[model samples]
Target: MTITARDIQLKQFKVKFRGFDVQEVDFFLDQLAEGFTNLEIDNRRMAESLKNAKIEIEELKAREEKLKRAYQELKKNLVSLKDEAQSPSNQNTSRMIITEAQRESERILAEARTRVERLNDDIQDLMKQKEMIDDHIRKAIELGKAILKNNDCPTNYSEDNDLKVKHLRQIP
Candidate 1:
């Protein structure tokens, strides 16, 4: 069982023959009680200190948790910021791509214009050839008519009248 200074101070012993000296034993007991009281005081002080230490540890742990949560939040924000930063570069890249496409479109349009010009030139050449062929056909018709007229094939035939001869013998 636990002993207290008060228990030690109030302790009694049955009187015995040839036992410890009464005054000396009493004085020793008194000194031992005083020592016990000092020890109890020290124990109480240590217990209080230990209780305070436990409270401080709990507070520190709570603060650490709060700081950890804050750190995690900051990390998440940093990641989000890092992701957000790429959009402008992507937009710039898209703009560059669009610009390139527009340039390519312009190049294609220029090529089409050149092709159209060449086709127009070819068409003009074809038109001239057609006119030349028509002139040749007309000249051949005129030559045939002149040969018939000069040979006295028909006396009624004239340039103003179309050839409506029904008989070849009508020509003299």
Candidate 2:
């Protein structure tokens, strides 16, 4: 059973001869009861904190929903305004709005084109880098093949020197 400091304080014992010390038992019980009381208080405080946090979260969610609804309402109003402006009775204003919207659309298109061009340029740069690396790899492979071929061929130094001298004589 749950015990509290007040329960310990209000406890009564019948006095009898040769009975166990009542005062010592009561003292220990009081200490244990006080500890239990503090633990209960702490548990209550933690529960309250959790409740507040949940309440705050719910409030934020409600506010977020309200803002989303407002945004949708604003979008609907903009559509309505556009429709009203396009009515047959408002030709001049409708034409003006159409022209402005077209200009804005063109500007947005131009900006998108510029961004696409920049992205394309970056892609081209990466392609060039990849091509350079491939070329270097091909050159290294060619050099390796040349080295292997040279190792297979036994060269006569005297014949090579004579050929080199003959080539020099033909150079003039």
Candidate 3:
């Protein structure tokens, strides 16, 4: 169950003939409440960050897939153009076919150039995203480490989100 500040305030302790200092108990409780607050805030911040990272990662993946599809289409078009060049049906009007093929080839070349440029742009974007994600992850790890080191706070996370983030990092 989620504990609230009221729960902490309402906690009771048994009174002894000469019990421990009440001020010490109160101080410890205050520190515990502050730790819980910090933990909740950090957890929320980390979750939002991870969500954004995953979104960017998905976008990069989609870009890569689109580039691959474009490349495949270009390859298929090139093969068709090559096959037409080798065919012998228009032997009498070979000049016309050559001229037409040359024009089509030029068009294909231009299209391929455009596709290559787009693919390069996608690659560059993905690279920049990778660097950003890495930087963000490193900073988060550093912050988590500092919190654990400085305050002995719990390091448990809500899910295996880090595994997915690491998987994205591994994608070249």
lDDT of each: 0.53, 0.53, 0.53
For candidate 1, the lDDT comes to 0.53
State the lDDT of candidate 1 residue by residue for 1-172, as single tens digits: 5566687677776656544346644665676667667656655564565555556556655655665565566556555555665687766655555566556555655655555455456545545654554454444334333433334434444321344243222322
TM-score of each: 0.48, 0.38, 0.44
Worst 10 residues of 1 by lDDT: 163-172
Cα lDDT of model 3 by residue, 95-124, tens digit? 565557557656655665666566556656
Clashes of 1: 0
Q: For residues 45-117, write the lDDT of model 2, one tens digit per residue.
A: 6456555555655665565566556556655665766778776788677667656755655565565555545
Among these predictions, the greatest TM-score belongs to: 1
Clashes of each: 0, 0, 0
Kindly indicate the candidate among 1 and 3 with the higher TM-score.
1
Question: Candidate 2: global Cα-lDDT?
Answer: 0.53
